[model samples]
Target: MSRIAILGEYDPTFEPHIATDRAIAHSSAQLGCEVEAEWISTPDCDRSKLATYAGIWVAPGSPYRAMEKLLDVIRYARENQIPCLGTCGGFQHMILEYARNVLGFQEAQSQENDPYASHLFISKLDCSLAGREMQLTFTKGSQIATIYGSLTAVERYYCNFGVNPDYVPQLKSQSLQITGSDSEGEVRVIELPGHPFFIGTLFVPQARSTVELPHPIVTAFLKTVL
Candidate 1:
């Protein structure tokens, strides 16, 4: 059986965390494959164990116990071509890892972690998106659009922070692309163009997944590793 490492502290009461586990099961069933998904606390994450997993899911619920460790894991996955899926807080860290390592913004930070940082690539959204479902349009021909088989989708958001608009232009590169946006054009999703599978979403797609129909995003992610 293939294994998947869920990177984050797991909370039984957190809806996203629970949904994340269930989403993986639903996808594996849909794909007719057996998968072992393990939740590894951020502070306990080690690259040696991480390399053994077929893929990694950077789970939500942040202000993680070990932020630097979380970022390092992301960097390892990005450089190694490991299929990676990040959502909500996971999405924020993905941008942070890229900014600090790839874009040379070593001081870049998430405003949630530091409101007065020198550079905040991730800032609190003007209006909270918790308990809300919103529509997002995917970039034509992008990986997300192709996976969902559509140009638009409505996903649930349990987050209050997102990628800062001021830094959006800097995030666009040959490899990393902003592939999905809300009606107002606020960035909602990003994907690595050439990697086997590397995607992040400000909204929690796992929350919308169901037993009868697992989310295409999660299914697509599992497909890469399986």
Candidate 2:
């Protein structure tokens, strides 16, 4: 059986984290593939050990114990084209990592982690989407659109922060494509072109997944790794 490493600070009490585990199981069963998913605390994340897993899932429950190390793991996956999925807080860090490493925004930071940082790439949303389900429109021809086989999707979120609108132009103009957006045109999902499977979403697709109805994104990710 293949193994996937879930890099995040585990908190059983957190709903999104719990949903993440279920989402993976649901996807595995739906795909008829036997796989193991191990929760790896962010502080224990190391590039040397990352090779042990077939893929990585940067899960929710942020304000992680070691943000820098978590970012390093994301960078490793992105650079190596490893199948990876990030949701909620995980999505926020993916943008931060991309801004700093790929877009030359070395000072870019998430407001959740650095409220007073000079360059805030990720900032709080005007209307928090915590515990809310919203419609998402995917960019045509993008990986997410292809996976879902449609231009629209309904997803759930448990986050208050997202990609700062101020930096959207730079991010989109560069390599990171804003593949999905909400009705108000806010970025809700992103995909890195040229990567085998690199996607992040402000909405936690895991929350909408079930054993009977596995979310397309999660199912697609597992299939990619398989």
Candidate 3:
């Protein structure tokens, strides 16, 4: 049984379990996988690294720093073949990482970057919807296809940044499938099966979770490690 490590913050957004952390602790317990929860802003991470865990789960956070730290860890973990799952801001950083490292775009960056990146991997969103309905369509015969299939999917969003629409066509052309998106067709879920474990979602899939019925993405994420 591989242990699950949750990279989060002391704040509610990252460790928001009704201010109790129950939502998170419970979700991991249901998997029967030992969990090591760490606070991004504080020193709650064991060994100051995530190399010990079988998988990494990056939670939500405000003020990019919280997410910045989380992204750094995700990048490191992915390079090591440790399965990684990033939600919301975590997802944004994952895209940025792929663009910069995998896609060979060193200048790639997000809206949160100091000089700001002008690419589609990360950019300001065009709408003002919160937790609203977002439509997603999976690529045929892709790993995401096996996960959600060709049926259009729906997921909740609380993000204001997304993979630039202009870069969508290019990213898809590079084999980085647009696994899911909003009704307006904004990128939502992205996956690179070529890697051992790499998947990201613009929304917090864990938000609509429960012990009886865990989110397929979350379950699938854990499966990658097992």
lDDT of 3 by residue, 97-216 (tens): 677766777667777564354554677766744567566776667666676545666666677677777666667667555676655666777877677767888877666666675666
Residues 49-96, candidate 2: write the lDDT tens digits. 977798999998888899999999999999998998998988889998
Tens digit of per-residue lDDT, candidate 1, span 1-226: 9999999989999999999999998999999999999999999888887767999999999889999999999999999999999999999999999999999999999999999999999999999999999999999999999999999999999999999999988998546999999999999999998899999999999999999999999999999998
Query: Model 2, stretches more than 4 Å misplaced?
Result: none
Best-to-worst order by TM-score is 1, 2, 3
lDDT of 3 at 57: 68
Summing lDDT over every window of 10 consecutive residues in candidate 3, give the lowest-scoring window: 14-23
Candidate 2 has an lDDT of 0.91
TM-score of each: 0.98, 0.98, 0.79
In model 1, the runs with Cα more than 4 Å from the true position are: none
lDDT leaderboard ranking: 1, 2, 3
Q: After superposition, how far is residue 56 of candidate 1 from its true place, in Å?
A: 0.4
Candidate 3, residue 16: Cα displacement in angstroms equals 5.4
Error of 2 at 132 (Å): 0.7
* lDDT: the better of candidates 2 and 3: 2
